[model samples]
Target: MPFQAGLGTGKLAVSKVSASEWRARSHAAEQAGDLNGALEILEEGVAAWPDDAALANSAGNAAMRSRNFDSAIQFFGTAAKLQPRLLEFSLNLAISLSRIARYRDALAVLAPFTKEGFSVARYCSVRALAERGAGNLAEAGAWFEQCLTLDPKHARALHGRARLAMQRGERDAVSRYQQALQVTAGDAELWLGQAQAMAIAGDTAEARKIAELLMQQAPQWLDGLQFLAQLRLAAGEADFTSHYTIAMQRRPQDHNIPAAQCAVLAGLDFNREAAEFARSAREKFPHLERFALLEAVYASAAGENERAQSVWNTISLKNNDERIHLARHQLRRGETDKAAILLDLVLQEDPTSISAWALISVVWRLAGDPREKWLHEQQGLVAFLPLQDAENVLPPAIAQLHRLHDTSAQPLGQSLRGGTQTAALLFDRTEPEFAALRDAIGATIQDYQKALPQSDATNPRICHPVLRYRDVPWHMAGSWSVRLSGGAGDRHASHIHPLGIVSSALYCESPPDAAADLNGDPQAGWLELGRPPPDLGIDLQPITAFPPRPGHLALFPSTLYHGTRPFTQGRRLTVAFDVRPEKEPS
Candidate 1:
């Protein structure tokens, strides 16, 4: 209680007075709703008193509210720099950068946040979006998954993933959208996203129901109206065409609904409307092969198979891009061998033609020759990817390659109650036999690398998946196992592996979500690995088709033909994969 006028106490008294004045001005400005004015006052106060982290942060808040993102960044940076221990400013900087589309920068900013990792759902959600827009899709996907793992109910992440899934044709996206609704039942945007996903999945019925709910919940949502129109047109509802035509009345650039409408009416004996819609779409974006494909479908349904085929032929020669679509139509029209020849020709010209490989995959699946196992792998590996995704769909043949020895059960490989099936298998998981496999092949690969000692990226064969086999390139990425499955009665297609690759399948546990489960869920479908057609001079005949057994394993060249039959019942199970020697470095 000594009235000793201490220097420190006097300095504190003066500091308090200045702080009180700043707070008063800020509080008044905030109460009056002049967030900008409050922010200006805080900036001045913090500038005068550089150690005042609170004042600096207050300015940042006001800057953020005013959408002055750059200023917010400056204020947050100053605060963070002045008080190096403060977590708030750094995190806020990451948030603001994310908002302004500096996602990669934001990610870099957030490296510090991973220290003891804060579970910021919105932070991860925004970061994932930024990464996606930045074209780092793989990283974005992993981030989106991380966001969901932290907060399964993270609405934005769920919505983004749903959109991604739809784009990748992962029919399960519709279910993810529904699950997102559980977390945000009141969120109209999530509802709208679900509607969009359903429509994309070709389910117009449920989309309409959700659209109706969205209209009720979010009357002003433009996406809801768009989805409603798409659903209506797809369902072939009365005057749906008129509805789309009229919607074009208010907002004519609605490519989404009209494109969908064109798709719906294309094949069901309705060419006139399909033509009209496709014409409008073509006017908007001329190079849509899907529309051309629709036009061909319309012509074919109208008993103009020649006209339809001509349309495909005309478009096919327009550019290399459309050839695959043309080939797809050829197969749909029962010209399977012709489609195969087209793809084969393309592959012969360019061994790594993505479109040719993709078409080859499609043909192999339909061909049902176990020899085509290599085709499926190539489809997965070499397709012209708008994005690498789940649709590198494993053909059923990749799992069980039945060389046309017999349409009967033959134990694959040596345990083969004879070589009645020379079929090779492919898988994704490891097995005990794979242990000797992992040891023997693993050692061989290492020794091979040691002898060669790769010095260049031109090594065609590189190990891709496993941790131990780190140096293998794409062509040489065999030697690993994968889990594959088929039901009681499934056969592979015909195909060949690439020049130096050896493919194999080792039976593992059956797909847990097999045929029985297929009927149990709307999203669940039977898992059958079918083969694609071969492109790269791979006239590899059909591999042996053996009925699936849990322990069965087969090893053979990439040139074998393979595919799977649609499962009627029981779960066909196995591990299926490929192995190839390292390409001699060129």
Candidate 2:
């Protein structure tokens, strides 16, 4: 191994004494906590001994730690090629590929290792994830079951099943998580997963308890503190500030907590405090773009548009580039024409910019484009027919849903605070009440799909419809009931479904005051659409407000911003779900 090694930016001498010297030196650097230094040493070693799989594998590990997935992929690929018998090398390569969203590539890498064996459970679970990522949910589910059959206690497989159950709005998610924890009670991640499942299942009180216990067990777990904060916020509790404080105290170096706190305060209209928090975070992590973005958001939320623009200008001018923040501000201010121009520039730079695509839809709508054209261009932007005859059939189902909510339900996902939600995936469950309601929804969806306008390849809504004729395959379904016993109900926040096409809220119960204005707010308890998130510092108004009426369903694009207005009194209950497109038969 006597050779001169090039370290990319420098050179290092390797001794013929042994190849182990380079690895030992790299190990020493890693032990001394100089991870970057270790990476550099490994790089030099790889350069000198190009054919050594061990050196390449070590380099790949270092690159993975550095978050250089592309470099890791290259190194791991080389290692796997050189050592075909080393399953670990192939697994590492596949994992790295998956990290970069190259699911097909990852699947290819793992193809040879998918046979039955003692170590096959990991392969099965990984393949499941890859299939899920590739939008083959059916295949993903099969692989997950395969993994469970091989190793029931497999942590990743169990977590995957739990996540799938959650996505499908299944009540059994909690049990699935509990089963996982039974096998590995000390796993903090498993505990967090259970907490999340509970939160999503509408058990915020229990979720908070679990989070608190997790924090006690792992004092430095920021996610636990964040979960507690989220649960408190969703419950509309007054003392939610302490969780953020505890989180910061646990790890002040983490800028995410401060950044998120600023957004929350801004959303609450605590502009002064939000601004202060943003400034503090900016001072602490001056180099991070996240805080600067937060500063701009705070300025915008405070109605200081000029200040917000100036902040964006400072950032863009310093970096000498066009920034999405500026375009977002334009959209927030209803300057669609300006936003269009800016977003075009953004698209040119990165055509796959989700935010840009999303904003373009809003801009087109605001600019008075036809619904068909705008919806088609936006993709994922469409409305379904409102359900009919719901007054007769819904009451019984509503009663059953409410009973579940009252007796055993938890609060809705932290996003829909102040509401208790049921856990059963309505369509999948066998309850007669749910089945009847599901039938109505399925019929309505079928009618909506049949009425959809014919289109060429250009019309995404028509071309990529999710409607299934023989069956209504909802990606996820659940019910949430918002009952404000003493005070105002908390509104659902503006957000998008990350894994859905058509999102809906079917009104099952509305308080007497739901249709009435509370303190001059006519939109109270109404489903609102098109408002940007408050934390983005843009104070855009809702474009549409669908009045809440029992037996009516408000269906809209999953990509659009939608939420409810907090009502002053009474209970509001609704069933919501995200639908995924069924794959075309081959």
Residue 305 lDDT, candidate 1, scale 0-100: 58
Let me know the TM-score candidate 1 reaches against the reference structure.
0.39
lDDT of 1 by residue, 1-586 (tens): 1112232454454444475577677777778787777777777677677777777777788889888899988888787777766666777877788778777787776666664344766667766777765545566677788889998877788888766665444548789878777877887777777776665555657777888776555444456765675455435465544544545555565556666556545423355667656755766766666666666655554545566777666564554445555665576567879888776666666654444554565566567754244333422322111111212222333333322222212321111111123222212112233233334333333333343322333323322211122255533332322222333333333333443344555443334433354435321212222233322222433323443443334443343344444443344434444555333223
**Ten consecutive residues with minimal summed lDDT in candidate 2?**
461-470
Q: TM-score for model 2?
A: 0.67
Q: CA lDDT, every prediction? A: 0.53, 0.68
Residue 245 lDDT, candidate 2, scale 0-100? 65
